[model samples]
Target chain A: MSPGSGPHTAERRGRPRDSGTDSAIIETVLRLMEEGATIGALSIERIARETGVGKATVYRRWSGKDALLVDVMKSLEETAPPLKGESVRNDLVSCLEFARRRGLAKRSSAVLRNVLGQIHSNPGLWGQYQETVIATRREAMHEVLRRGVHTGEIRPGVDLDLLSDLFTGPLLARAVLRPDGSLEEGLQEGLSEQIVDTVLAGVAPPPVAGG
Target chain B: MSPGSGPHTAERRGRPRDSGTDSAIIETVLRLMEEGATIGALSIERIARETGVGKATVYRRWSGKDALLVDVMKSLEETAPPLKGESVRNDLVSCLEFARRRGLAKRSSAVLRNVLGQIHSNPGLWGQYQETVIATRREAMHEVLRRGVHTGEIRPGVDLDLLSDLFTGPLLARAVLRPDGSLEEGLQEGLSEQIVDTVLAGVAPPPVAGG
Candidate 1:
């Protein structure tokens, strides 16, 4: 059965179906991911069995494994509520806290590690990852940085791309490279503030004398 | 034939054997790595065959694939000479330049990417990589940061660990995550200096008034 044709046929005919099955499949995918299933190993049949849903239902929702995984990642992003802070520092800390919490979460870290392991070999997944994960987070960071620049909290002409990398790279490295290292605890607590402080020290304009 | 028991028995008993075979094997490993052979796929048998040497010879010098791959990484480190500069800023720039050059080198980046892709699954390799790659480079950065604090170039009491990550993490993320991205050329030229400058701006002590 083609995507959206099985369980959603009733919805197409005028009855709106509940979205629980959709979320259940994504949750199952995340759980399977935490249990060490990689993109290359994930199949609709397996997901269907694990989620206790019919294969036709899964097919009716996601076109394939790639689309399912993409939706799963997108759902992960949605878990972190939008960053809302009055100042750049507050916004950065909030954004970083979201990242830190996600990194420290057991399932999130496992899923991330699995993706990092296979991303090089999977271009379609990587493209989706870039779009859903990297680009979305980058846009949030860009907004914070631009606000900082406008308010004169950050220096003008700063390379936002490099600056964004500077801000997020350390945390990412910790999460990806040292997945089992002791630094994970450190990152979970105060490291985000330290990163923001240090980055701001560089990007923030010099303090006005006696003002 | 056992390792070192056949081809190098006479040399083991008498005069020192030429180091040519050692370098040849490493060179071939680098070449094969560039060709996309991972450490798991790079067996002594393959190295011996490709380098026109006996398995005993390859085994004699290195106990197994793990030791050989470790040595290959170690040799790459040796290519970038130790960082020495009169000041912390200069030292940082010099160190980053070394990394940039290595990242941009034809075979080096591919070898690194291959290692990164497989390192998490292979503890032996991951241990060796931590020691030979991460630890060595980190020590250099530590020295520079320490000297920067000592000379009042950098702010005292900075978290050197996180700061070190900030320095190298961006380049690493670019190399590993965006392997074929166009940012490579940008990295090879001025990005290193830019990183150093931005980081130093964050870490540098306030300028002394009229001094």
Candidate 2:
């Protein structure tokens, strides 16, 4: 049915949402971000203009800029593949491995962290990003830790949430801070394993075990 | 004899180095940084202009801008104070405690870290900062780790350098990344104890004791 040719066609203005347009708009936003445009600097209209799409097309999908950014984070999140349901230790490595890879993949993971941090100036955007994206990943890690606790892989008394940060911090500090950039490249190759193992076995001697 | 009247005064065309002028110069650099100046944006000429001193006066103190910044770092380092040397665990707590305090004191430690990271674009300046300021701190931490090993407070066979990062990483990640900004304040107040204790006591159940 030719849309404008008939009254029925005119009434039926509906068309399937173009996934290609959605993808192009999303990529344009990411490209701008990687080029050093912060989340604070980007707008839906600018993104639409850059992507060569109408502003209405962008608004039709996401409610606003923050909504658009949450989706951008989601796209970035997808780059970190899903964790395998292996042993708890193995899963922990997977989490860090993803972080390590992300750190290496980006010129400065700070760009991403900066984006997250900058949005704090806007409570609505920050809360939305935190609740939707950060909380979800945090729960995933907590779920792994909780499962480990049930299996006795993790100790009973330790905090699962804090445990997650402990496991994740060193790799993150390296990636985001760039403090250790001068260390020999080979030193960081097995970082995921190195951190997880050292931590699981306390730094103090065995007698001080379970301290 | 009056300094101007004496022949000796003419020969000694000097006064004791004015510590006041030095403080003024360093404070000006810090104030500018807090106002969002990067290391690359700073110069001896600009600093002297801002501090209301002559370029020659600045040159007499620090040979160049990087030399001046190394002193700025030294001033910031002074704020952290000396470790108590009480025990490995106690010293570790002191280290994280200082980090926690530093994070709280500044609006952004990234301002400090960013200054460091941004300087990496220049190999010479970065190397100077690394060798002088960062290397000295690294050795200090390594020395503490070595002393702990000697006292049997820390375990043998661990890399002292990597171990230091593991101990400090969590509190730092929260500080630098701001991921945990939304968490309860009390949660982080005890962070130094939380990280050092959790890390000292292995997270894995006892059956995996030394793994």
> Interface-residue RMSD per candidate?
3.4, 5.0
Candidate 2 stretches with Cα past 4 Å from truth are A1-18, A35-68, A79-86, A107-111, A179-184, A203-211, B1-77, B110-137, B177-184, B187-189, B201-211
Q: lDDT tens digits, residues A1-211, model 1?
A: 6554433554776876658888898899888776656655577898999889899988877677766766777677654576666878989988887877677776666555545545544567777777777777788889989999999989999888888888887887787667665446644478888899998988888778887
Residues B59-113 of candidate 2 have per-residue lDDT tens digits of 8777666667766765666445688888777887887776667666553453454
**Best-fitting candidate, measured by lDDT?**
1
lDDT of 2 by residue, A41-78 (tens): 46777887888766766887898776777677666655
B-chain TM-score for every candidate: 0.79, 0.70
Residue-level lDDT tens digits of model 1 in B25-79? 8999998877655565557788888887788778768887767877788777654
The true-versus-predicted C-alpha distance at residue B164 of model 1, in Å, is 1.3
lDDT of 1 at B181: 55
Q: How does each model score on TM-score?
A: 0.75, 0.66
- Candidate 1 ranges beyond 4 A from true positions: A1-75, A106-120, A186-188, A208-211, B1-68, B116-120, B186-188, B207-211
Clashing pairs in 1: A4-A60, A202-B202
True contacts kept of each: 0.51, 0.37
Q: How accurate is candidate 2 locally (lDDT)?
A: 0.65
